[model samples]
Every structure is written in structure tokens, then in C-alpha cells.
Target: MINLHGINCPEWVSIGGDQRRFDDSGKPVDPSTADRAERVLATFVRLSSKVSA
Candidate 1:
């Protein structure tokens, strides 16, 4: 996990059994997929922080 402005960002994400994705830099193998995943992760972090706060 990585600390991003107090948000704990995962190094990698697992989609399902034996289907782990993302690299050590937290980027998906495919550029398009990475972009989408980044957006989703950012939204999740934003919402989760708001909820916790």
C-alpha cells in the first residue's frame, strides 16, 4: 500500500482468483484500462474519505 495525501492506495488490485492486475507502480498493464482504473480509484478514495470524515 502507498500513502497518498493520507489515502492508502494499493500497490496492486486483484480482480478475481488468479487474475491480479496492476504493476508495482499501481498502473494497469493496458493504457486504456489504466486510465479507467485510475478514475475509479480516485473516485473511491474521494468518496471514502468524505464518508470517514
Candidate 2:
């Protein structure tokens, strides 16, 4: 895991083709796979804020 809860990763990248998403047609959906990146980034920010508070 890349510790997504601790960093903002908005780009979808392939790592040995194991970190990719697939569509209903069994094809890779590269662009849509990073949708959670922003959410993860937001979570990190929230957690950090709590810790700093």
C-alpha cells in the first residue's frame, strides 16, 4: 500500500500492472481509477488537522 491516508495522490499510475482498475468489459480504466485520490487527500488533511488541534 502507498499509505494513501497520509498523502495526496491524484494521479493514476501503474505498478507492474497490478494497481490498475478494470471496467465491465474487462478493460483497464486508467483515468477513472484515481477518483478516490482526492478523497484520500481530504481524509489526510482532516486527520492532520485533528492531530494539530
Candidate 3:
């Protein structure tokens, strides 16, 4: 049996800061601005496919 525990964990919706800004060390602070929705939607489609199939 596939364990579906914690499937809807709130951490799944967490978003990081925009990566347009750089930190003092010249590194991207957080690069999650783009593709957040696309990634989540992809995951939903994948999981749903598994369940339906």
C-alpha cells in the first residue's frame, strides 16, 4: 500500500523569495519566483495520474 500520509502538508505550498536580488556574497538569495505554479501543477498531475491509473 502506498502511504499517502502528509500528502497535503502545508510546506508543499511554501515559496521562497524572488531571485532577482542578490545577497552580499553575490549569490542568489532565493530563486523560486518562477515555475512555482508550474512545478506544483506538474506534481498534482503526476500524483493524480498515479491514483487514477
Best-matching candidate per lDDT: 1
Task: After superposing candidate 1 on the true structure, give the runs of residues whose Cα lies further than 4 Å from its correct spot.
Answer: 1-26
Per-residue lDDT of candidate 2, residues 1-53 (tens digit):
35754644344334346447567896557654455554556776776787676
Clash list (residue pairs), candidate 1:
none
Model 2 — which ten-residue stretch has the worst lDDT?
7-16
Clashes of each: 0, 0, 0
lDDT of 1 by residue, 1-53 (tens): 23545654444344543334667896566665666667778878777887687
lDDT of 3 by residue, 1-53 (tens): 23854355222445454646657886445556435645667788787777676
Clashing pairs in 2: none
Q: What does the lDDT read for residue 42 in candidate 1? A: 85
lDDT of each: 0.62, 0.56, 0.56
* TM-score ranking, high to low: 1, 2, 3
Query: Candidate 3 local accuracy as lDDT?
Result: 0.56
The lDDT of model 1 is 0.62
Error of 1 at 5 (Å): 27
State how far residue 36 of model 3 sits from its true place (Å). Answer: 0.7
Alpha-carbon lDDT of model 2: 0.56
Q: Which prediction has the highest TM-score against the true structure?
A: 1
Off by over 4 Å in 2: 1-29
